[model samples]
Target: MNEMHHRMARTCMVYTSAALLALLPVTACGDATEDVPTKTVDTSALQPGSYPTEPRNVADRKPANAASIREAIRLAESMPLAMEVDKQYVYNQSSSGKIYAPELPPQQGDSVWVENFGAVIPGLVVGWTSNAQQREDFALGRNIDQTVLRFSNPDQAKHAAKVLSEDNRKDSPAKRDVRIPGHDAAISYVTEQDSVVTWMPHDDLLIYTFVTPGLEVPPDVDYVIGMTKTALDKNIEMLAGYQRTPTDEMPDLAIDTDGLLGRTLPVDDMNKSGATEGVYSPHAALHLRGRADVLKRAFDDAGVDLVADAGARVYRSSDSAAAYRLVAALIDQLDPRYETTDAPAGMPEAKCFKKSDRRSSRFTSIPQFQCLFTNGRYVAVVDAAQIQDLHQKASAQYLLLTDER
Candidate 1:
């Protein structure tokens, strides 16, 4: 794999998908439809299973807004996220939908979560990387790292840096001051491999990075110090004043796409109509009826709002296979409460249920296969749109979750 993929392909990519027609009026949903030259970013440029990491923008570049965010997403969408998972490597196709990682990431899923800042997201450590070598080190559970963390504001971010620095200086017998970036900064070296963890306070964000090899790899403090200087130079502008949002259209998530039941590429795959739209993260209208609180708690735990009426239309495919594909992609990304263990007979053992709200319309309940399940985090779920079996249009995608390997 190329270095870029090594850096950017570290799990925690949140998969979200919907049917082509599930999302309507492309202008809505914050998608930019400007007529730009058509371009196909073949992933080969970055090596198999990876792409270039987004350059640091908030610091030197203009802060990103809704329009810019959409433009980037559109650009990323235009590219094909094809990885050569050919027969060479033996991938455990099962277990591809684990919501949280089994261990501290570089694992998958739970590696990247929204920063809680004060009380919201705890134990949430954000790391940024741009080097392929370093990327491999991180994924393999090594100490070499170069990841970025964003915050709502600069004050909170700087305070966080200070706290981190203070906490990490106790690793050595002779308590010495940790090396920080600037005179007004504090630093820490928690491990010998990670010589110094410098926190650079930039506009609207804080960058915590290290360039030193593991303490065991080399004790070249000079080299380590040089990297610290480089980090300070590149991230100087990233400190404070500029306030904006962070967006990386490239899906950094991982899932076993081959695990998808029908691995054979269908010539007339689900894209028969050139369907390019997939509804991901749409507000689901769940009827509470007498179970308002019960459903509300479910929705709350599910991290979505439960409404008696939904503003958007949720269309179900007439094709059972197409519909099955849609629901499968949804399960792969949404991580909904599909733990009812209610899969259909003869189908693979999956946690599926026919539980639907009373207000369910014909659109959601199309005449087709309605079961849903996915492999736990076995493979990376980069592109949901590509997974829907297009050739199997006439039939429904009645795939089953695989048994434990």
Candidate 2:
């Protein structure tokens, strides 16, 4: 079948909520009418060539003063629960739902099992298998958060890095917090400006988001991250665990991505690279060229009156799931299945929604909303001026990046 036809057929993958056989229909071999034996590929055996090799220079390199982090938690103790916020999204393509929490979870004291669902959500991209190492380190009270956040396992970390950097004009550096196992502990890293971003994992439903400034070291974001880490540690046991389970299961993800075209190398439609004994995709090279072309066209076709990619990618903004939920709202409008309407109040609306000059600057102008698309599989965020052009070109891009979304 042709790519467009395949894209349409994949919609069945997104909409199947009934029979189990229908779950991965596109993956089904032979004729649809044939009652063939189901073939299941062991994910673990997919090989490891797709992972990245370059080291992420921004992971929490050193541990913060334990006393300082604990102190930060103490300061946040009195913060009103009313100030806390939770945002959620249910992807129509893959029935797996996601929730984002801006406020730190409440905590008791020691012997804590404080699982930050928001922070945990980012790890879902690689299946949170790395957390197994963190869990072991957590039991031993070692710096497991550092290992997990550092992108230690080459295959998964590299895969994540490949997808993340696909649209790279540059990498923005930012502060990231890696949770310590037992005590109210954390490791902090001061990322090169626009160079580092956070990927908070929630079991397998990873949340690719950014952090808000608060406790900063030397009175900046670095210090704020430390304070936030400390606060989480102090209330470790007190913080609430989300009523969500972690898994790779996605339901009702019907999508017609055949029109989507990608510059990135094609690898299992998921955009995963380095599979099967470390073979690299020629597609990565293509992705880089494509990103440059799209960006150049965006500047020329639409005035670069306001530039966003110059800062952090909005998906890497304060709450990524929130960012995606907003995009989901737009996608829901574009495609009806994405109709869940519960977003956090005061949640900033998308900047491109309104053409008015005043409204145009409202959301996009904020640094919080600055985000970019990675791996062609993730959500794409365009500046206000480029929205129309993006919409015009979206179908092909969607097929290329998500191919099935």
Candidate 3:
């Protein structure tokens, strides 16, 4: 028999043995049974085709304000992608629908509005923020944070825009009123360090944009103001396409209409505080990724429209071919600290990587091992501390995807 056949035979033997089963770690292994009697398997009858290639159906659950959350997610898709503001704004830090308090610019005073603004901004239904920077090093590149706040009516939104802008101005004597060209209704100001803050009301939404220059760059009021305008214009144009859920119907907005979240691995409660567990549109997902600019191109090329995040991340592409392209793109974009490694046993299509050194960075966490695998139109990524654990997770994820019931 060939070397490939020999390897498969060995893997089958190990999988079928009760001894190895007992040695396996207590990790997620889909449908893995315990305390099974050892059995002799006919290796000659086994083929690579035995592996699963399709995703199994999973049940969906709804949470409170599920419909409103779903609408916010759709609104996020309409938010200007960082690249649209500027190609250099490539590193997206955060994007979500859970905006409560305004994230003001640096050096801005701690206003009472920062703490009790929610009480004043009535009819606040939902909000989204798309924050990005030119580089991972915050001290070395420009940054832009665009926020969209939705209210029950246009009047309430208009009031919010005015109150938020005035509160910031009143809290800081260093804040000087500024005018944005061609935007008479825009409330803008230049604060210390030359950062620009602008608030504009559009229909039933309040659009807020903040821009800051790199520390090394000299403070240029015009440049910051220009960037603020650009961000506002992009946001306005993108939001024009958004169709908000009617105020009365927001409470009944359905969640997971596409069922992407149901198939994703659920997040651990222990890690819930730090994890963003939900289904997101492609642009919204970019805000949660590293090297988002590069991923945007890959996503566009692969026709990736939906992404689900929890314990593991799942990306839905247009087809098997597109999924493969996305996998390749992801592998190619790995940080320099990682190196390619062997895939899970008997799973040739899966790609795995291991960190090569203990390089520390305040901005990012480096996982010890990461594995990416695909099932039909879906691609999933899982991280683990050990190669063995990674393999087990990959195996379980594969089975989970293939499980039809």
Candidate 4:
């Protein structure tokens, strides 16, 4: 995908519920009764040279604080998902600390200190925002945001938490101190806008949580406190298993350590340098998806350990059977407007879908066509505006995945 299109896909929030799949019909093979036109490609004559087998290597490719940036991405996967706090908070967005300036605070006055604090900016900051309703109408439901700031040591984390709490309390007199149930060191207060904010320092990391109610109800202090507690507890538990990279070894951190990105197809040569195209852990991949809650279970069941996003999204499953199951699960979770039409001509293992006449103003930006296919333990998903283009991309992706070299 191009840079512009990748940005749009990252922020766009239209999603279909997993439960809705029961109402739609899907087929692994083409529907004979459907008159959808398909393009046929000569698979036997396809050459591996037609698609990129390895990611391009740029000279002097290192970015500023590359090690810290990479560690921040790793920390993001350990952060708690919104659904873990409450089932209602199934919608979420993930962000890395690298997005902000390391030496300066965020421009917004009421922003979380984890993004960037006065002289005490953390080595890395990762966050997730979960909502009870769809993005188009999030104001109608509850929302919770969780952020983790990893400092150089326990002392720095404690100092950063202290500085943030003191500064925030002095910023406005309307802020009222609120006591958490079991966290005595936690500094929490209710803002004038009725949102609850909490900052707690644990070991070498600072945990931040913000809870806000929907427009339909008055701010519930008890609900806010309960949710904040749940978020903190879950984060602490998950972090116990995470091993932070040593400060001295961060700069040498490898980008494609497992060679997954090298094997995946790359975008067109002109747009190959985009930052959005990279390999990610299964948990990190959830941040880029719309229905992360539903996909989480599928990812775990299929043992989907790695994901690579380039011209096509590639997933590494445990085995071929798991890959096929993942593809079926993906097709079932597609928006209801998409109907199973046909597989790419001459490729029975592939499955394709096209948007039907059904109209919904909420999902206009979604791609009109998508195709999914598996080659051994790897599953690839490709999208396009035209059926012919989708078929060609699918064929090329299949060849790239099956290449022996």
Candidate 5:
């Protein structure tokens, strides 16, 4: 809960096998729950936001090439994935980025699907998003974002902008052309959604903004336009940086954050502003590299099969009626019914467990909560600690997976 506690709380999230969980009950969370209290800090004398200012020293900093800098930005904005990295608690939290070819899904030339962007403008060079975290923010939600796509060259960028402008003018309502600083940008407001969308072009990058779903209240037209301006300003600064002093190395970005969660359930507990270092709890921490050997053996022992479909890996059972039963049995066999936690209301009958009891020094002190349940034809492993309300999000995820979308 506090800064020092987070560091000393260096606990790992373990997807403990039944055989493994047995080793802990005697001296861990089941019986021995004593933990050293973390030390407290005094914020009285220090300013609440005190941080080290940029130093005046001028050694060991190497500026990268424009291409490398651009490439780094592109890597940061890899699409299909959510905005894992963005401007955080810093003064500037807006950035433009693109994805390298290898990181994207397998494509056949023009067959790429822009996952984060609207999937319309093809060659996505500078897909930008903002961290305008505030209340009542649709097209401008801090969670949802908008971006414009551009190709490699200026001619391509201008051509894409032209196509978007023509399409917006013909199809979008309340169409208007506005100037951003020295550039002419297209702005459109849709009455049906009460949201505004904008597109601007500068050199090789195409900038755009729109309403995205948010956790808080839905956003309105004014908030979108204002944030678009903010995004545009940040874009101008980034492009300028590319021209002038390039960064030695790009700032670190968030990692691909999925390990123990169900395929349908998304786990993004890392703070966008803080990168991975700003984790709040084990709710978002699941690193299952060395932890899945027993899981594989268990599956093999039970006759369940694993298969890959459309880039996603899923566990399958030969019999449809017995599928859920088999999956539940695996968990039950490992963790008995009496030891299981009751299923949250609306969720299928479930059992819960923690991978580690923090019984040993090698194990993490952090607590990892694993919620195993069944939904429809599949057994679910929902890490309730990953999200705020485990029941609601897991239920919603189950419904969304069942839906026709």
Candidate 6:
């Protein structure tokens, strides 16, 4: 297999096992029969069983919705998530409301669950199942992750970084050799089962995993992962993810060393810099950022909020940069219940705003971008049109208004 595939496989194996181990007790409940058998089974010793496809009873299944998404994830999270037997029923819900059965159905229904343990090297996915109910535990393609956006939370990547750091201190090998495919070397760490982990690699952040098994990772997952392979790609991807590409040609400016003290990137100049629009719509970014207050002002000021802020910070004096940094620092402040990370592969908390038609800031949601200010600070912006049913021409004013000396 390719490097990324190998890395992903290995990394997934380690973390998946760890995560499964973590959830074992929770899924066991208090019932003695519910306890997971610790018996090891050699995968080679067991014969592969043929799985009969189970017919989908769409009528019995719950219709997909925000609530259903929640329940699916909850069920996946709470199960004694381990593959114990060589054979089991692997059921999946089709887009057309049919349940596709696994090649082998070990067991069925709510009593059955998947596991990740196998004999002889203990391969990746192992679990159990039964066939009475239609609730697909690991249904892919559902918008379950969308539900996670609610309830102010910490970025999973940052949490991974912290875990890596701690593991490094303890001399963990996983921390030293983790890589992010073609992107950068990552400091891989474990997270709750079926979650993502990340790390910082210089100016660019590299995320290692987004563990959503049995679910098709949103196209964005591959898009983000593939594009983040290079520094140029990362810069453009970050901007594009926010839908803020420069519409015009390049700009010319001089090196401003004074603006970049103790900051993330300290470039010599931005002369002859080009511009391009984001891959996603500004409106999409607003919804993704998901902060009502910041969303309001950012969407209104879509075009300039992120770019202008970055430009200004790129040109700001030291005092201004320092002050802005202080505020920027608070963007991803941690919560006792909402643990976040500040290291590589993680995003920091940020104050956000939206733009009005007149270049003034307002409360709206839609156009979104991250502000990199002249004072060396970062803020977030969202699209206005997405905030409501209203639609208007969102003219992002400058390709790059440079200081032409």
Candidate No. with top lDDT = 3
Q: Residue-wise lDDT of candidate 4 within 1-405, one digit each (tens)? A: 222232233334332111112111232235422322234345674434355544445214544534444666677677666766676666543221112224223433223542345445554342232223234334455666666777778777677777776666554333578988878878888876666778898988888776765564567777778888888899899878778888777667775646666556555542212233456687766655445667777787668899877567888988776777777778776666788877776677578889888875343245678888777788888877788777777777776676453
Tens-digit per-residue lDDT, 119-202, candidate 1 = 532332222222112221233322223334444466766765765444334322212335544535535442444344565655
lDDT of each residue in 278-379, candidate 5, tens digit only: 111110111111122233333443334432111111234333333444444445334322234444454444455544433332332222445544433444
Using Cα atoms with residue i matched to residue i, what is each candidate's TM-score against the true structure? 0.32, 0.22, 0.73, 0.69, 0.33, 0.20
Error of 2 at 265 (Å): 36
Cα error of candidate 6 at position 63, Å: 45
- Candidate 4 positional error at 352, Å: 4.2
Candidate 3 per-residue lDDT, tens place, 1-405, comes to 222231122222211001000011221123322312133222232232332333423323444434544666778888887778888887655231233222221111211134356566677776766666787654577777677878788898889878877666644433588988867778888776677777888888888887776665467778888888888888888999998878677656555537666666555441222223567887777655456666776777667888876557788878766676667667665666778898776577677889887463424445678888777778888777788777766665565565452
Q: If ranked by lDDT, best first, what sequence of candidates would result?
A: 3, 4, 5, 1, 2, 6
Off by over 4 Å in 5: 1-144, 148-150, 168-171, 175-182, 185-192, 211-224, 242-405
* Candidate 4 root-mean-square deviation in Å: 7.4
Q: In terms of TM-score, which candidate is strongest?
A: 3
- For every model shown, the clashing-pair count is 47, 68, 1, 0, 12, 76
What C-alpha lDDT do the candidate models reach, one value each?
A: 0.29, 0.23, 0.62, 0.61, 0.33, 0.22
Give the Cα-based TM-score of candidate 4 against the true structure: 0.69
User: Which regions in candidate 3 have their CA more than 4 angstroms from the true location?
Assistant: 1-60, 94-113, 166-173, 215-217, 270-276, 339-349, 354-357, 360-362, 366-369, 384-393, 403-405
Ten residues in sequence with the least summed lDDT for candidate 4: 16-25
RMSD in Å for all candidates? 20.3, 22.8, 13.8, 7.4, 21.3, 28.4
Locate the minimum summed-lDDT window of 10 residues in model 3.
15-24
Q: Write candidate 2's Cα lDDT for 243-279 as tens digits.
A: 2221222111111112121122222222111111011
Candidates 2 and 5 compared: the better one by TM-score is 5
